[model samples]
Target: MNHEITELKFSVRFSDCDEYSRLKLSRLFQFTEEAALADAERNGYGLWNMMKAGVGCAITRMKLRLNHFAPLLGENLTVTTWAKENYKDKVIYKDYIIRDGQGNIMVEGTSSWLLVDLKTGKALPPSASPYPIPIIKEEALPEKLDILPIGFFPKKVDQVQGKNTDIDINHHVNHCRYVDWVLDALTKEEMKERGVRSIQLNYIHQVPLHEKVDILRFKDSKHHAVFFGMNAEDMKGNPLKARCHFQARVGFGE
Candidate 1:
């Protein structure tokens, strides 16, 4: 399948807003995904349709930079998405959010996607088949992890069991499951005492099916802690997957 640059427009909904009336951080990713998929469908290569043809698109990693907050109720917001470049095994996709009327930039994000064979659940080379999608030069990715600090420390490690239900059609852990992990890493008392205001995460790598990922947590300061996911190594103690950084806000009675 050929990757192409596509754009989509949507309105900010009441469900999308936070207490401050601004769009929630997590919903930004959801909106981006929706727009990108809509663009693909408009171009005749929707993700599900591609999957039916024996190809599946998988998000391997992502980086999001939130800029100006969008809080206008019923105001249209335009989301533009396109593939920056294509490699033999993966393609990089970029998304930009802007106010529809003024074109003011709201958020910018980039995600890396891999094409895989539906049967084997392994990555397929981009050059393995003729992709109808147009490819552009790859965008430069950030060298450092971008995330804010979350107050509080986890007293225990969280265990996530990847069952069949936890697996998506692509046979990997669902992206939302990562969010579940982040929330689960915190104790109930912590959540009751302090609400999470904002969060940022870089998806470094995919968690494979049936693999047990240990959720590790460490407090960097009084108001900040780092959380990551890791799998057991063969014997040398090398991590099987790349580490991801998660930042959250926690304080006061919500």
Candidate 2:
């Protein structure tokens, strides 16, 4: 009665690609999320179901390893996702993989999520779920590194407000939008010159609609970049004073 793994097929569209025609990293996240949602829905623990039970899921961290170059527009891709059997510290883990039509792996990722009481906004244990969640023993991409911290990155790259379009069913900015905000911190030339090899993000707090956020970036190394999203008004003069919304680290290929 439970589908331990879920797969979805997709075709890269112009909308899903960057100006150079490669698949956008944010779109890749979206595809992965769609597969996860499909799996949950099939298992009877979908968004609405969880909400009706007074709890909702929120992603806490994500790490993705990419191929040498992103997939091109018009390419056919298949995304697969599954929940790991191990649930610890009130957090659930999910794994994802994306392959091209030729079955070449394009991306491998793993994400951590927590369940929250919708009414109180407090984190809940996995046992709070109304349905018996099924899990797969396979680990698509095992997490190893500690999540990136919100360092005091001096360069403030951009500022943005959580728009209506950025809001998701959970009434918070969608995870993919956070991906976009981080990637946007990089210059087009830098992105093209240094193709992304890996991406890691830690979602510390959710931003509601119309909330202003400050985007900061640090080119910490020749092949690495770090970013932080903080409350714009709350930042004051010290980054430490602001509530960090997310932290991201991007590794670039040579």
Candidate 3:
């Protein structure tokens, strides 16, 4: 198809940032996902169109790298996304880039998604789409997204419950929502004192509504703390929905 990258513009609000005035990771995901969705809609095959046709897209995996805190609140940022290619039938790969007004790259991401039937929740089998698929060249990650190397540590977790609002068109906890869960699990004092420097996530499974999830914390010498998320099962059990790792510091300026 076309050679243009789908771009979305955003002005960060106070609500979109951490206490340190850095853009929240979840909000960045929202902007990035919206850019991708808008591009799909323009191509006649994005979230809105899929929903209207009783289909849904599920982002199965995503990993993000942040070079610095997102431009401060109220700053304008541009996000661009492109499909990598038609991958294995219903699955496709996509890449995202976030840039500041100065044209510096702020965040880079790569994600994998599968289109599925709404009713069956099964991956749609290979079929020719009525529309032409845009070839999104895969963006190489500086560091690969793999299962976080879980270190042996005593379990110390903060709990959260998935809410109905967490479900998306796919009827599962929205992928980006997990970032909030991880952040919210932190104490207000903790959040006020640090800003996430960089973060990565690898989604393992879709979390269902109202499941009590655990944010398992680990001691990290490199980052402030390490966190692993689990749900989709009873609290005592372990069925991981996603894994996240991040580094935090005092942040740029105040």
Tell me, by lDDT, which candidate is best: 2
Q: 55-173 in candidate 2: lDDT tens per residue?
A: 88888899889975889999999999888854664788889889999998988999988878989989988877787577788887877446675455468899989998999887889
Error of 1 at 108 (Å): 0.6
Worst 10 residues of 3 by lDDT: 245-254
User: TM-score for each prediction?
Assistant: 0.65, 0.94, 0.80
The lDDT of each candidate is 0.59, 0.85, 0.67
Q: Which ten residues in a row have the lowest lDDT in candidate 1?
A: 245-254
Clashing pairs in 2: none
Q: List CA RMSD, all candidates.
A: 6.4, 1.7, 4.4
| Candidate 3 lDDT over residue span 1-254, tens digit each | 35678888999899997767878878888887889789888777866666777776667667666776557878889888887766666667788888888898887877767777777867874254444557756574533345566655726466776688888766777777877876775677666555555555667656667766667766655545556665524445543424332211112112
Best by TM-score: 2
How many clashes in candidate 2?
0
Model 2 Cα displacement at 199 (Å)? 1.3
- Per-residue lDDT for 53 in model 1? 83
Please give the TM-score that candidate 2 achieves against the real structure: 0.94
Better of 2 and 3 by TM-score: 2
Q: How large an RMSD does model 3 have?
A: 4.4
